[model samples]
Structure formats: structure tokens, C-alpha cells
Target: MESKTVLYIILASIVALGIVVFQYIYKQKAKSKIYLLLAFLRFIGIFGLLLLLINPQFAQKTYTLEKPNLVILADNSTSVAENGKELNNIISKIKATKELSNRFKITDYKFGSDLNILDSLTFKGKNTNIHNSLSALKDVYAREQMVTLILSDGNQTIGEDYSYFKAERNNTIYSMVLGDTTKYKDISVGPIQTNKYAFLKNKFPLETYVSYQGNTPVSVFVSVKMNGKIVHRENLKLNSDVNFKAISIQVDANSVGIKNLEVKVSPLAEERNIKNNRRSTSIEVIDEKTKIALVSDILHPDLGALKKAIESNEQREVSIFKSSASKNVLEDVDLFIFYQPTAKFKQSFDFAKSKNANTFIITGSQTDYTFINNSNIGIEIENGYPQQEIFGLLNNAFTKYDTASFDLTDFPPLISDAGPILITSPFETLLGTQIKGLNVQQPLLSVIDENSSKRALLLGENLWKWRVQTYRNTNEFINFDEFIGNLIRYLTSSKNKSRLNVDYEKVYQGSSNAVITATYFDEAFLFDQNAKIRIQVTNKEAQKSQTSPMVLKNGYFEADLTNLVAGEYEFIVSVEKESKTAKGTFVISEFDMENQFVSSDNLKMEKLAVNSGGKVFYPSQIEDLINDLSTNKAYVPTEKGTENIVSLIDFKKLLAIIIIAFTAEWFIRKYNGLI
Candidate 1:
């Protein structure tokens, strides 16, 4: 309380005493025992009422003992369930230990595909993500002095490696292995890499690793099969020192549609697990091809580079033609590459507009800006004197398609006419211009879609230099070629030109849920938030079908196919009140990630323990772990104190006392006929 409040309280008491003396002694002039009692009552009532008006406050201090957090994370994946009996014993002992229960607050969780409070364990999770679980706990107990205990087989099938995870300085992590440690003779095939889309009549490459675990020299045959027929085969010899072999083979995409392929390795005679000896994957064989017409007024090396890059994919063909001959080839072309277009190319642009075909416009010194602007191509450039060399800076916000595969940081600059460019149409800039180490916020490559026609604008020439630089850095042309191919694919793709666009993957792992997303647009091309979307899924093998509504989330309509069984599925996404619909197919492989391991990864568990300032123990040594935690000096309880100010007027007991005093005084007066 402040000095002013103390002064007010003292004055209130003195005033109360004076008022009581004046009433009982001065005014009444009576000397009796009753008079003394009346004076005391009056003094208390006046003081209490004055004190309420003053509202004096008092300080209070409170102390509490905050217990440290003890988090127990257990593996609920099927791979660790083999040692469930031992795991249960360890958990029971920890729970029954009074030392730990009194020393810290205990929280139990079981994790596999997700983390959940410990109620019971079914051990049916298809995947294990140890890193994700640990990351979540780090955030939840960031401020608490926490000690984490994990029980798992260390067979992480998904997410990044947990051995590299960094724990908080105030927190410690201990791991307990919970599977067989004995190594057995095993041969497995895994980690198959292949493209999801293949061109018909073309051969696609598939790479896989065959691993063996045994001391004896063994010979096995790795084979690729399609529709129960062997397409390719190879023989491999392995010993204890050389137990791993990488097998790469190309299989013909003979037919169209979805093709399911299986890769198998001959298992050892005494192999304990054969579930991992074979892997299945799916690839879609597309028969549709795109034809591109590249028309230019002058011959340049960029023309050759663009043609080579765009034609790298077997599904696309690029034909070069002079500006005068562009009109004859525009009839059958799906896309037009207008390179440094001049007045002579006016008819080609008009033809492309009439056919509603997509075009990739490349501008340079020879570009006729007046003709281009008059052609109504949604862009206008004011040509200036000297040419500017601008480097490409990738735009991270570009959403039309993915450009993650391109590394534009060290690319060579392109030559363009020095000018101030203006684009009236709304466009997604794929690459912005950077001149002399400064970002100019100008578009180097942009895409626009209007009137159902898609067009891409490149504000410079000499793209061949970028391709050459990419090849020099990466020692391959695939990266640069794929980058150009993606742009061409985007321009020629018919799906983006539609009002309803759907996106999904062609292949998914059975351990994870498959998701299909869609976007609906109004007549003005704005996102329609009120649109309702639905999907109908049919299993190709099982011949069963189901329909479900897609929920709107974060501006996209999504459907989760978590309940679908592992097989090939075909789905159709449609809008409820509109005729817009999209059809696609996907395959879910029945590959259980958790079941791929035959023994616990003890090395990883040990590394994780050492990195987190803890120890690794097995189920039998859990008692020692408990004792260590109990004696650890860093995991002690902390003393927490809090101070609060409480007002005296807020007390109900004070009010009760005032009421009682007044009542007593009234009764005395009434009994003495002084009412």
C-alpha cells in the first residue's frame, strides 16, 4: 500500500472514533455500561463503512513446487509389437515406481503414423515417423524441464532420419530398443525409382537396389515382370563384403493407360522375411503427343536449343519454319513458338488467335513491338536504344506449375531490347529480371490465360546460353531440357484452360492417405468459394465403387481417400451444380513400410541417445534407466512463487461484521425504548 492510502485509513479511524464519542458521550450525556457498548458498536460500524470507501488493499504471497515433465513415447508400429510382452513390463515398472511419480509429472504417448495419448496399443500402424513425433514434443514442452523416454525398433520408414534430430538443451532423450537384435540371412528389394509417366512405344528406366545379409557367397536373379510376363532379367553375385547391387533396366511401354510393374529378387533359402523381396510400381503410358511450330524471321542458335529442349520428351515434336511459311503449318500445330516476331509474323498470330491455340512469344532486338502490341497479345513494350543483359531470378510464388527442378541461380543472362514493358493481362511470373546484381521486379518469363487461350511470354533471347550453362554446371542437359519441356507441357496442356481443374498423384504408398484436390472458378475466372465438389472412386481390380463429397479447405476442394483399399483406382471429380468434370486414375501399392524390417536398428538408437545426452537401453535394462532418471540432478523440481494484491473491501466477512454490529445496536435501543 502507498503512504497516501495509509494516511486515509488513519483519518477514517479517527473520524469514526470522534463520531461515536460525540453521539454517546457529548450528545446523550449518559454514563452507563450500555452507553459503552453503544459507543463500541457505533465505532466499528463507522470504521467499517469508511474503510469500504477507502478500499485499502493488502499484499499476498504464494509458493508452489513445479514438477519436471517426464514424457514416455512408445512405438505403436507393428514392427515393434513382437516384443510387446517385454515392453509392457517396462512400462508397468515405470508407472509403479513411486520415486519417479513423486519427482516429476508423467505423460505417456504412443506414436506410429501419428502421436496419441496412451490408452491401448493395437500395433497396426503401417508407417513409423519418429522424427515427426519428436519434433512435435519439442514444441509442446519447450519451456518445461523435460526428460523423454522412447521405446521403438528404430525402423523409421517415413520422415527424415531421427538420428540427426537436435534436442533442446534443457531436455534429454533416452531410447529403449524393442525388437530382435539377432541378424538373419535376408535378401530384399527396395527403393525402386521410376518415372510416373512414360510415352507409348518408348522404353522407361527403372532402378532398384538388391541387398543381402549373410556371410556366404550367394547368386540371385533380379527380374522385372509386367502383367505376369518377364520383360527383363539380370544375374547378380554377392558376398559378405559386396552385398549390395544397383540394378537398372529399361522396360518398353508397349501399350497405353496404367501399367503395373513388379521387380523381384530371388530370396535366400533360409530367409526369414520374404515380404520385402518384391516391389510393385505403376506408370501411366500416355499416347497423346504435342506438335509445336517454331517460326522466326532470322536464324539464331536459340532456335536450335529451344527445339532440342522441347523435343527432349518423346511426347512432343517441334518443327521449325520461316515466318512466311508459319501460316501453312499453324493448322495442325497445338502450340506456336514465335521467336523474335516481326511484321511478317502478323498472319501467324492471327491464325493462332483464330484457332484458340497457345503460343510462347520470345522477344528480342528484332521484335516488332508495334505489331505485337497491335496484335492484342496482352503485352506492350516500348523499345529503347541499347540492349540489356538480364539474369533470371525464379519467382517462389509461381503456382501455375512446379519449377523446383530448375536451378536459375547461376544461369547466364539473356539479351533483350532496353525498354519499359507493360502487361495488361493478369499473369503469373515464372522468372523475374535481375540486372547488374539488382532485382528490377520485371518479368523475364510469364504465363497468361485469357479467352480460353494460354500464352507464355519470354522477354529475352539467347536461351541457348542458359541451356549451355546448365549443362556445364550439372554435366548433363536433362535438367535444362526438362525445364523447357515443362514450360511447353504447361502451354499445351488442355486441363488448365478449363474452368474446373483437378490435381492428384498417379502413384501413392499404401502407408499414407491419398488426397485429390480441385479448384473451381466462376465465369469471371475468380475462385468460387460456394462451389460444391464431389468425387466418385472405383477400384479397378475389386470392381467396387464409392462416392464422397470433397470438403473446401484453404481455397481448394479436397477429398481424403484414407479408407480405400490398396489397389488401382479410377476417380471422377465433378461439380454439383455444373457440368464440369475431370477423370483420372491412380494406384496404391500394398507395401507396408513397418513390416519391411526384420530386426531393430540398434546403431541408430545408440546414436540418437548419445546425441541427445542420454543412454540407450534394452527392455531388460529399463530398471537401470528408471534409477538413472531418479538420481539425475538436472531433472529436479523447481520452486515457483507468485504475488497478488487483494482488496479488503472485496471480503464478504467484513460486510457480515458491519451488518451484525448494526443489528446489535438496533436491538439494544429497541429493548431500552430508544428505537
Candidate 2:
């Protein structure tokens, strides 16, 4: 309490005492034993009430001992079990150690593809990710005194190498080697590289690296098979000096739809792990092709750039023509690209409107703004000025299609007529304009979907410069080409427009979770929040079927099919209280990534231990690990203290005493006829 508060408390006590004395001794006519009792009660009651009003607080300090944390991470993957190593006995021994338990705070965890609290171990995980588990524990125990113990074979198949992982804090890591550290004669077929989509009746390239682990020369036959029939085969020879070979094969896409292919390498006779000798993949063969026409009166380099980008995809073809060409040119054209449209292109624009064809319009200084505004193409420019350079700023809220991968931050700007541009129809802007390093609230590239027809408008020219800059930054042209190809595909696609859409992959690994997502829209094509969706999946081989509802998450419905076995499955997604459904098929290959390793990765395990200031020990040396942990001088308990201020008003007992004293005085006075 401060000096002012102490002084006020003393004055209150003095006043309380004076009131008691004057009423009982000085002002009374006679003194009695009852008067003495009354005087004492009054003093106590008055003083207690005054104390409550003052509400003085007392400080309290508390001390506690905080022990260091000992986190034990046990491997629960199939690889550990297949190597004939059990971790339960070791974990039980550590838990039973009384000295360690009394000195440290122990926590138990199990990890395979992910990390979780320790439970009954089954060792049935199909994939191992050692780096992910360690990284998670490092984050959970950051900036604290901690010691971690990892028990595993270090055979990870699905994550980055664990040896290179660096800890963000000062932590001790000890590893227990659990498998036979022997390198056997083995042959594996991946990691393979190939395209996911192919054109029908065309050849697609598939490349793979075939490796051998032995001391002698070896020859293997690499074969590609489709639908259980061999389509291509080649023989490769490798020796101890050259233990790996890059094999490239061209496979023909004969039919339409998805094609599942198997790439296998002939294994050695002494190979103990044959699970990795073959790999499975799928490709979708498309039979439909799009034909685009670029109608422009002037011959510019931008025309050639656009044509090359569109033709990068074998499924699309572009043809350039003069605006004065006859009407027959528009008959078979799926899409029309009007470049800097002027008075000469009025007939072409009229024909496109009459046919209700999708169109992409590009504007520049040469463009006839009066003719374009009068054409009633859903866009109008008012009070146009001289041409100026405008840079592009990507709009992150654009949901019409994916533009996240395009890096347009530093691209060169385009020349456009500076003015207030207006669109009479609903549109979504993909890129906003930036003028002279200042962001202008205007659209540079936008798409419009009205009257069942799609149209895209670019209010600038010199787009070829952006493509050139992309190549300079990335050392390739695929990024720019793919962006243009996706834009053209969205405009020219002829699929029936429905309110419900489903997205999923056609192929999935057996160890991965296969997820199917869906979106439902109302009659106005806005996202419907009250819609309930369900999925019915059927196994094509076993003829078994199951139905379940999809959970709504982040404005979309998702269904997980991780429990399904390896096989071909067909599914249908339907919306409740509506006549909407989507059907699709997918294949799950039977591949166990855990079974690919012949032995434990001992070198990586040692490196992880050494980098984290610890050592590696085998299962036979488990006792040494425990003793080392117990005697480590750095891992010790520390003292922690906390302080709090407690107020006297918070005590209920004090208030009870005050009430009792006042009541006793009132009852005594009333009983004596002084009421």
C-alpha cells in the first residue's frame, strides 16, 4: 500500500474508535457490562466496513520447478516392421525408468506419413516421411529446453532427405538404428517423367532412369505396356562404372479417353526388393481439336506471337486472315480474334455477332474507338486521349480461372488509349491497370459472359513484349504460352454450361488420399450455400458400392476416398432436391512406397544425429542411450516464479464477520427495549 492509502486507513480507524467511545462511554448516562460489549461490536463493524471501502491489495509470489522435456518419436511405418524390428519393448523400458521420469517431462509420439500421439502400434503405413515428423516436433518445442529421440530405419519415400534438415533452435537429437544396414543387389524404375495429357493418334515421350546396385555388369530390358499388352521394349547395358541409364521411349496414343500404362525393368536374379521394379501411370487422350481464326487488317508481330502461343498445344490450330476475306472463313472458325478492329473489320464483327461465336478483342492506338463503341460490343470508351503505356497488376480475386502461376509483377507495359473505359455487362477483371508506378482503378484485361456467349477484351497491344520478357526471366516460353493457351481454351470450350461442377484427378497413388471436390450454383450462377451434395462410388472390379455425403468446407463440398482399395472406381456426385449430377471414373494403382527399400539408410540417420549435436546407437545399445540422457548436464530443471496482487474485498469470510457483528449489536439493542 502507498503512504496516502496508509494514512487514510489510520484516519478511518481513529474515526471509528471515536464514534464507539462517544456513544458507549462519553454520551451514555450510565456504564454497564452490556455497554462494553456494544462498544466492542460497533468498533469492529465500523472498522471492517471501512477496510472494505479502502480495498487494499496484498502481493503474493509463488515459485515452481520446470523440468526439461524429453520427446520420444517412434517410427510406425511398414518399412520398420518389414525389417523385423520392434520398438514397443524399447519404449516401455524408457517409460519405466523412474530416475529419468523424475528429472524430465516425457512425451511420446508415433510417425509414419504424419505425426500423432502414441497409441497402439500396427505398423501398417504405406509411406514414410521422416523429415516431416522431425520438422513438426522442432516447431512444437522451439525456443525451449528439449531433448528428442528418433527411432527409425530412416527409409523415407515421400519427403525431402532428413540428413539436410536444420533445427531452428538449440535441441539435442538422438537416433536409434532399427534395420539391417546392408546394400543388396537391386533394380528400380523411377522417378519417371511424362506428360499427363496426350493427343489421339500421336506419340508422347516417356523418360525414366533405370538404376542398378551391384559390383558386376548387368543388362536389363525396359518395356512399356498398355492394357496388359507390350507396346514398346528396349535393352540397356550398365556396369559398375555406369550404374544408371536414362531411357526414353515414345508410346502411341491410339484411342480416346484415359490410358493406363506400366513401365517395368527386368530385375536381377539376386534382387530381394522387386516392388520398385515397375511403375504405373495414366494419360488422358483427347480426340477433339479447336480451330481459331485471327482476323486483322494489319500484319504485326503480335499476331505471330498469339498464333505461336495458341498452337503450342497440339489440340489447337490457328489461321490468320485479312479482314476483307469472304464470310466463308467464319463458317468453321470456333473462335475469332479481332486485332485492333477498325472500319475495315465491320463485316467480320457483324458476322461473328450473327453466328453468336466467342470473340477476343484487342485494342490499341490504331483502333477506331467511335466504330467500336457504336458496334455495341458491351464496352464503351468516353473522352479518349493520346496513347500511353499501362502496366498490368494481377487481380487476386479473379475466380473465373487460375492466374496464380503467372508472374506479371515486372512485365513490360502495353500501349493503350488513356481514358475512362466502361463495360455495360457484368465482367471479371484478370489484370488491373497501373500507370506511371501508380495503380489506377481500371481493368486492363477482362472477360465477359453474357447471353450464353463468352468474350474477352484486352484494352492494349504489344502483348508480344510480355512473352519475350517471360522467356528472359524464366529462360523458357512455356509459362507465357500456357497462360495464353488456357485463356483461349476457356473462351472456345463447347461443353454444356451447368450450375454444378466437379473436379478430380483421373489417377491416384494407392498411398495418397483421393479427394473429389464440387461447387453448386443457383439459377443466377452464384454460389449456392444451402446446397447438400452426396457421392456414390462403385468398385468396377469387385462390384461393391457405397454412398456418403460430402462435407461443406470453405465454400465447396469435398469427399475423401482414401479408404477405397486399389482398383478402378466409378463415382457420381449429385445435389439434393435438384436434378444435377456429374459422373467420372478414376484408377488407384497398387504401389507400396514403403516396400521399395532393401535396407535402412544408415548414413542419413548418422548425419541427422551428428548435425543436431548427438550420436546414433543401435537397438543393442539402448541402455547406453538412456544413461547418456540421464547424465547430460545441459538437461536440468529450472525454477519459475509468478506474482499476483490479492485484494481484501475478495474474501467472503471478512464480509460474513462484518454482517454478524452488526446483527448482534442490533438484536441486543432491540431485546433491551432500545429499538
Candidate 3:
């Protein structure tokens, strides 16, 4: 239909011309001689071969350029909580980008630990993992021509490691710093209380960690105030990155009936925020009392020591019944302390069983081992022989620090323990090992549930002597007073509630929806009670709150919080009832926004344009980029080696040419005396 002068086309045209001339001469021939026939054959062969070489090409290039897609990912992480509404304003600007639609398709990503395109938003995660976000975007659109524009503060959380980015010289990272880089001092309270329960009217130790950031030095006020009264206060001055700057507070666990305790820290005037400077924890104190019974064999120095130790416990009543006393005393006791208490075995065991009293056995020279194992109690000390006086575990907890307080180095030791690791039948173990008769670990401490329901403490060796030794740590309790005080407190402690802990790994941009979960272990936390949960946020101008579900499984309730903004948010759960009030707190964080900053680096948005024969532009250079794209400024010319698949679509011209070629070839063959 149309002609162009290129190498292959010119050669094809010449061959067509030669075939036409010969065909015309052949057609003018009058006779059908042998030479005519031969000439006609040659003409047919040449024209047919040339016709196959009539190469034609068709193409339509629309010299139009489009504005590449522009994704302006905004950071919504908590780190930027100080920036006020600057970030929101920027996000709004990009969201209303309809004017740039022809030149660029803009997507708004509001991210923290991960990336989430903004819509009428509802809930999102806390934390900032920007590196992960951009990496994820890159993986999704590796073949696309898109430009990623990052607007954030310089404090990066995730991305290529700093070393990797610098090592690889990934210069594609275009940063539009948002927050003012001016250093402003800030102090925060991170670590809080570890234990949830304590004895009423007693001192409870709480650990809190404080941190200071920025270039300048700053002073902060730390206080433990209860019901608006200042109980404890400390003034501290801190420099940047100083570790171990912590404060410990020993607050009185308000008497047995009090339930709420508030601990607050005073932030400096120049501080970033104040909500995190204070927190409140709820607790209940146990004051239930009990009565104890003390049983000893001889009036040795050890018996006197035992009496004093058992007397310190207000709940325990020690009645020393020497074996020689008249057997006419009627006893109603809760616990029994047997110091070499092996006597006319039948009577003693019967009284212990009748009173539902737990027995604590201490072996000595007059002990009869043969019938003891048959009575069902204590660890089996088969090698009743003397052993080395070396230190080991007290129970299951290992004591790494040694002190002369419990000076057992003079006597052969029996596994170096004062409590139990085993238990016996017909009785429940309160602490330590159970009695196997022939062994030493029979209820180191136990509870008998028969009649009076009493408990016992079995001092395996002579611990009264160690209370008189000297050492720095536990040695302070080197006297029977402090030592026994610790003992009584341990025995009378309550075991009621179970602690609820929620743990999960954080996922950002490069993450899939992992199982966000919570599990419970405290039995006191009743799943049946509608436990209400409220999430508190401090990142934005207006604090946001969300209620979590009460989905219970195996005594634990779960609520999956996925697709959340990157930042940190705290969840507060409260259970209100007629007789009990319980509360728990947990935190969930995402570094997606911080990581998006990192991920955005590896994504070569400008390179995509460069590779696909396009130019790059900034917000101000959009017009020029468009103008160049509309012309031949950036389109790379095609190569000649790969043009075999050209096709021409002109039905009329093709049909006429086919008919003319056939007729011309026929006439030329006849005229040339070939046919």
C-alpha cells in the first residue's frame, strides 16, 4: 500500500521490477515454441520467488507521554507525635492531587511499622518500620514504573541497614525531612512494676527505668505519690545515651483493703510529652491468718531456736510438747514443726493425722529409719552417712551469691536445701520435696487436708546456727529473727490469681498478617466476667481509643489487631464485679513507618523511568518532564536487526498489486517465446 526506502525494501522492489518486465515480454509472444516454454518457466520461478520477498511493515506510534505514578508515603509513627498537625497537612495536600492525575497517579500511604493506604481510616498498628514498607512495595511492583516520594523525619527505624545502604551506595533515597531536626530534651519512663501481689501493710519494691534524649543535658523529677500525697521523690540530671539511670521505689502496699495505687513522674518543662510520665496499677493485698503447731523432741539449743522462729509468725501458735510430758493434752492445731520428733511412733502419727496437721521431720542420732519410710514421707537419704558441707540449690532456684549466713560448711550437707522438690501421697505439698520414708525429701514443707487442714515447715538441717553468721546479702538475716520473719511470710503467702501475658513478634511492610494473639495464665482472671478492654493512643493530636473483643479459649481471651499503623499503643483491661476488681495492661507496637523509610530506599522509582526511556522530575519540574515526554526527546530509536514481523493492513492495495503481478508475469513469459 505504501513504500519506504530501506535496505531490504529496495532489494525487494528491484526484484519485482525485473519479474514484471520479463512477464510483459513473454505475454507478447505468438507461438508456443520450446524456447518460449523454457523462458516462461524461468519467469515463473523468478517472479514467484520475488513475490515472497515483498516485505511490508506497519506501525503506529502515538507520541503521547503520561505522568508516572507518584506514591507519597506519609509517616504516622509515634516518633512524630511531636510534630503536631504538620504531617496531617502534608498528607491532605497529597490526597487532593487530582490536578496531577494526567501527569502522575498519586497514592497516599499512612504508615508506622507498616504501610497502609489511607481511606476513611478506622484502626491501625503502632510503631514505625518504614524500611520494611518500601521493601514490600518494591516486591509488589518490581516491573512497574513508579516514583516513591518519602516525607518523614530523619530518625529512621527500618530499611537497608545503614552500613548496607552506604556500602551499596544506594543513592536513590530521596528524603524530604519533616520534623524540625532541632534537638529538644526529652525524658521518658519505660520500666515499671514486675510483681502484681504483695502482703498488706508491707513494703513492696517497684522498678522503673528513666531515659533522656537530645543533645543538651536536662534535669527531671521522679516521684511516687499516693492519693495526692508525696511519698517518695528524687531529682536526677541526665546526659544523652546514659544507661543505668534508674530509680527504685518501695511503696507501702496499702492495708489489706486498698485496691488502687497511682505512681507518677514529673516531666521537665522542655519535655516532649507528659501522658507517659505517669501510670496506675491495681492490686489486692492478702491478710488471711492461720494457727501453727510446733513439735520438738529434746530441749537442745535447736529447740529454743525453733520456738523463737515459729513465734514470729502471728498466725502460728507454737506449742512445744516434750516427749516426757503427760499425754493428757487435747490439741487443735493447723501446722506441726517436728525437730527430731520421732517418738512412740503410733501415738504421734495418729495425733498428727487426727488434727489434720502436716509434719516436718528433722533426722538426728536417735532417729529410727526402718519404720519411717513405711509411714510415707521425706526424701530417701539411703547413704545416711555423713557427706561434704558444700552449697547447692535451696529448692529449684539457684543462689549464685554465697554468704556465711547459713554456715553449713562445718557439717556434711544433704543436697543443700531448706524446702522441697518432691511430694507424698495422702497430703498436698506447700513447698519443698515429699517424704519417701527412707529418703530425706519428704514434704520439706507440706499441707495436710484431713481434719484441721494444717501446713508444716521441715528444716532439713541445723539452720539456726547459720542465722548467727556474718555476710553482706542474705547474711543480714543471719539472726533467727530476720530469717524466721522471711520464713513465716513465705508460708502464709496467698496463691489465688493468674497473670495474663500477651506476646507476639512485630510485623511491618515486609510482613504478612501473622497471628496477633494474647494468652492468660492467672486463674484469678475470670474469663466468664465480661472483661472490657480499651486501647489508649498518644501519637496524634486527638487521642484515639478502641474496644477489644472478649473471645475466650482455654481460659484466655484473644483479639486479633491486624493492619494497624506503626506505633506503640497500650491496652487497658478492667474487670468489675460484686466482690473483686482486677485490671491488666499490655502494649503492641509496629515500626512500619520507620521501616518504610528504609524500604523506600531500595525502590528505584526514578530508575524505572530511566530504564523505560523516560525522564525524572521533581514536583516543580513536572511541566518539563511532560513536555519532553510528548516529543522524541526521550524515546530511544528501535534497532534494525529485529524487524521481521512487520505487517501492512491495506486490503485494496494488496489485492490490486497481486492481480497486476500475475498478469504482467504471464504476458512477459509469452512474449519472450517461452510459452
Candidate 4:
């Protein structure tokens, strides 16, 4: 189509014609028409090949009609369907509405613990999560002109408040409120809060919140039960119609294992729903104290600070001593805190290593790099210089454990030597180094896993200043105290160097689906899928047990144990071939999340609809909902135009034509004895 292309075509044709005329009918002539036919075929074949090399494009236009989406998101949890017949009738009317079906693409989703696409409701979910349901609706209808209809009681037993849910799209939302809004005469026990661990023979405090709703004065008794036996009891009086009171009681830990404790509030007269009258929890009891030996060369404030922080944990007993005091005390310790190891303390360091104790080495201005370099502690200072002030930079990629709730950027600078270090092991850096407010790619706090040992290194000193600065900014030492506590917990915990490792929470709520995950390693300690793992779970009190095989998933093994009831359970994980074993205990507490409250929250639903530019309707107003959807101008069908392009070089028929033209010319010349 361009003039340049036309000129190229003419030139190719002229060259092709000259060759064909001379070759076919030069002084000795064939048939007159045969000469013209040969030249024409030759020109066509050559010109077609040249055109193909140009690689042109062909396009086609198409039109599509897409109806706007009418999504009906239903809460399938048990609370929403307390009145089942009424809910079913509302659903039937919405489904049978002919006007909605004719105008939009209607979709149904049932959400509770999870979301599913089904035409009917079962109402078997143990919990209702309104926030998650709305979030799922936004994700499922992202690209459509969506009009979402929600049907729920507005009772969120889990997740955050849905009234604060921000819409992800410019879609309209309408809600049909369910459940009775009238408050009933009830007494309930809220979630219990207490310490997770207690030392043997020590009494730990437990706090429980009691809620009452009634016009009459109520007298309720709160009791704590351990292993189905009452340990403590108290009585309280409520005068207000709706009031909440926190009851405190102390329980003694006499045994050393996982102790199952239950806190219950006596139900009042004429109380029909008694599921929320009680809640259960579990606490771990340890008989042996965690002995932490802090060894230093001098009496500095940093030494005193370390001892004070570690002792704040009631379960730990910290002992301070000089590095040269004696090696006898190190024999019975579980953890060693070494501050600024020098050449003179080489023997003390060797003695700690010989006993296979977990060690935390703190480097400072007085550290002897040459002595530490040859200690085989998985860290080496490559070069040394004068001291520098560097702030702590947290490593976002650290996955060994969770960091405490504190901002590392605001902490004061720590003093460390201006030197480079070489870490020749598998390490995770908890905190990196920042100089002059610029982050440097170096480790300030790191952990190393080498040769079946756990080690930690803090590459700076003057950690006392961090505590002082933290208190000045926040008016409290809670952040600094928690950071140090978490670090000690990580160091003192047992390291699982076995070929098979099982990961599960020590405590689970009954309202959730409990899942256990595991990993298998080969002889080289790398993850291997070919290994087979199985687990046998036993109820400690019931004396009943069941074994289940784990299925391989995403390079690990997993098993679902959501069917287990509330009780203390012990699990044994084993590999049949390797004859390895791992044992642990987990407790499932009675959740009672849905039964905590039954009244509907109509105000929340009203806010949701108004904020999203729509109207709220009661369950009986389903017909009105259909009429509003049909008449709304924004919820109309959409038309889209699409254009598709294809390349000429990809046309197989064109290539075949070019090939046949050349083949026919060769055959014709051969038949005429001009080959």
C-alpha cells in the first residue's frame, strides 16, 4: 500500500520477467501462450515472497455485552440463622425475583469461617465474621459494575469491626438486617487473661470479665477449676441493667506439666442460652528454674542492667560472676551471657563450650578481636579499627522469631569497633548497623545455627544507654525490657536439629479450624519430600487416641485436626524408617465466640449501607430491595468493544501458496524438457 512498496514490487516483477522470457523462448520458441504463462508465474512467486518478508498485520473488531453483577453475600454462620425459616423465605424471594435475573448477572456466596459458592445455606459455621465476608466480596467482584447485597445478623464474633470496612471499589452495597435487636436476660463470661507460664509452687493471678444484662439485681458466683476440680471461687453482685465486672483470683501451680484451667460464671434463672457461661485456658508449669550465668571482666552498669532484665521474668534465676571467679558454677547453668571476652578469659569460654551451653557474646570496645577470631564461635572479625557510634537497624527478613513491640530507629547509638566481620555460617541478622543515619549492610545483632548449636552475637556495647534512652522517650522501660526478654527467650529455647520437625501452637481456640504443619529433612539437613511422617494424638484425660497420616503439601507435611474437642492432647510425631521421634502437647480451649452475644447490631448495618451509597432494609423488605436494584441508574448493564490483531507472517495458507507456485514452475519446465 505505500509507494515505496509498489516500486519494489515493480522492480521484482521486471527482474523475474526478464529471466523467464530469456530462458523459455529465446530464438527457439515454445507455444506463444506458454511463454507468457511462465513469466506470469515467475513474477507472482517472487513478488509474494517479498511481500511476506514485510510482515504486515491484520485486525478485527468485536463487541461484547456484559451484564452488571448482582452479588448476594449471605452470612452462613449459625447466629445469622437462629430463625431459619425466616431467613429461608427471604432467600427464596430474592432468588425467584424475575426482574433481577433479567437485568444482571446474579451470584451467590456464603461466608463464615471461609467463603464458598453455593445456592443454598447450611448455617453450620461456628463463628460469624462480617469483615471477612465483605472483604471476600470485594475481591470476587473486582472488575464488574457490582451491586452487592448482604444478609446477616451483624454479629461479628471474630475479626475486626465491619463498620470500619473501606470499600475497595466504587460499587454500591445494600444490607438486609437479620436477628432480634432486643437484649435478653443473660449472664456471660468474657475471655480470660493471665500469664502463660508459672513456676512450680508459685501462685499466679487470673483475671476474668463477667457481663450481666437484666433489670433485676443478680448474684453470680465465679469459680476456677483445674483438671475438673474447683481450685478457687468468689461471689459478686451486679446492680446495673447492663454492666461488666472483672474478677481476679490467684491459682497455685502444684504440678509440672500443661495444666488445664476452666473459669465459669453461674447462670441466672430463666437463662435459656448457657453456652457463654464458662471459658477455659491452659498454662505451662515448669519445675526446674532457668539458670542464666552472666560472666563479665569488670563491674559495669551494663552487667547490672543485663542481670536486672533477665531476673524480671519470674521463671528465670540469673547469677552474676566474674569470668575468672570459678568454672564450677558454669557446670549447672543452662545459658551463658559473656560480656567482652578477652585473651585472659579464653579458658572460661572454652569451659562453657565444653559443657555445650547456649552462649550470647556481647562485643564491645574492650573486646580482643584476635582472641575471639580463634574461638570457633561462628564469627570472625576480619579487620579492626577505633570505636564508632552506630544505631540499630532491624532486619526485615529475620524469621527466627518475632521482634518485640518497639521502634528500633528511635533507640540511642551503640558503641562498637569500626571493623568488618566475616560470618561463615547460616545466620539470621536480627538488627543491622546504621552509621550517620544511613543504613549499612552489616549485622549488629545476629544468630547462627552451626554444628547442632545455637549461638548469638551482639556486635556493639553500651546496651544500658538504649534502656535509658527508651525510658526518656516513652516514660517507661517496657519496650527495652520486652526486647531483651524476647532475645533471652530465643537464646534459651531448645533447638530442633532433628531430621523431622513439627510446628503447632501450644494453645488453640475451639471456634477456629486447627491445623498442624511439619517439615522433614534428609541426612544433609535439607528439606526432603520423600520422607514420610505420621502423628498420633491422644487425649490426656479421656485416654482415647487416634493416629493420622500427614499429606505432603508445598514441600512440607500437614494434617487437619479441627474435629478434636476441648481438652489437653499429647501428640507424638515419628518417621518409621529413621526411627526418630518428636513429642509435644497442645490444649484446645472452649471458644464460645458465637454464644457470647445474640442481639442484632442494626446500627452497624445501617452505617455500612449509608457509607457505601445505598439503603438498609429489614428481612421483610426483600421485595423493596428488588425494586430499588432494578430502578437504580448506576447498576445498569455494560457494553465493551474489543479489537484483536494478527500478523500476516503467521497465515499458513499464504506460505503454502508460495511453496506451490515454485513447485509448479519447476514441474512445468521439466515436462517441457527445459529442466
Ranking by TM-score: 2, 1, 4, 3
What is the full ranking by lDDT, best candidate first?
1, 2, 4, 3
Q: Against the true structure, what is each candidate's TM-score?
A: 0.67, 0.70, 0.45, 0.64
- lDDT by residue for model 2 (171-196), tens: 78889989889889888887656787
What would the C-alpha RMSD of candidate 4 be, to one decimal place? 11.9
| Residue lDDT tens for model 4, 60-150 | 7799888888888788877866766787787678778888887888888888877788667888788878788788878877876788888
Summarize candidate 1's per-residue lDDT along 439-535 as a digit string, tens digits: 9888899999776688999999899998898889989898889989989988888643578998999988672668999999999989998998999
Model 1: which ten-residue window has the lowest total lDDT? 322-331
Q: Which should have the higher TM-score, number 1 or number 3?
A: 1
Alpha-carbon RMSD to native, per candidate: 10.0, 10.5, 14.0, 11.9
Task: Give every collision pair in model 1.
Answer: none
Candidate 3: segments with Cα more than 4 A from true spot: 1-69, 77-100, 103-105, 121-126, 142-145, 153-173, 177-227, 234-300, 303-336, 340-359, 363-408, 412-675
lDDT of 3 by residue, 1-675 (tens): 355525556676566556645654456554445435544454545544544455456654444444444566666665555453665655565555454454555676777666777663322334556567666667655654455556555455545532122211111233345544445455666545635556655777877777766666777777766545677788877776562377677878666642344456677786655655665444445564455455556566666666666665544556777544433552654444556545455466667656545555655544544445556554333424442232222342323222224333332232232322333434543334323223344444343333323334343555555444423324444344544555454444434334544544322221224333444433565444344433222323235666655465565555555544433344444333322323333223222332222112222434433443333444344345334433432222322233243465354565566566557656775785545
**Model-by-model lDDT, in order?**
0.88, 0.86, 0.49, 0.81
Q: Best candidate, TM-score-wise?
A: 2
TM-score of 3: 0.45
Worst 10 residues of 2 by lDDT: 77-86
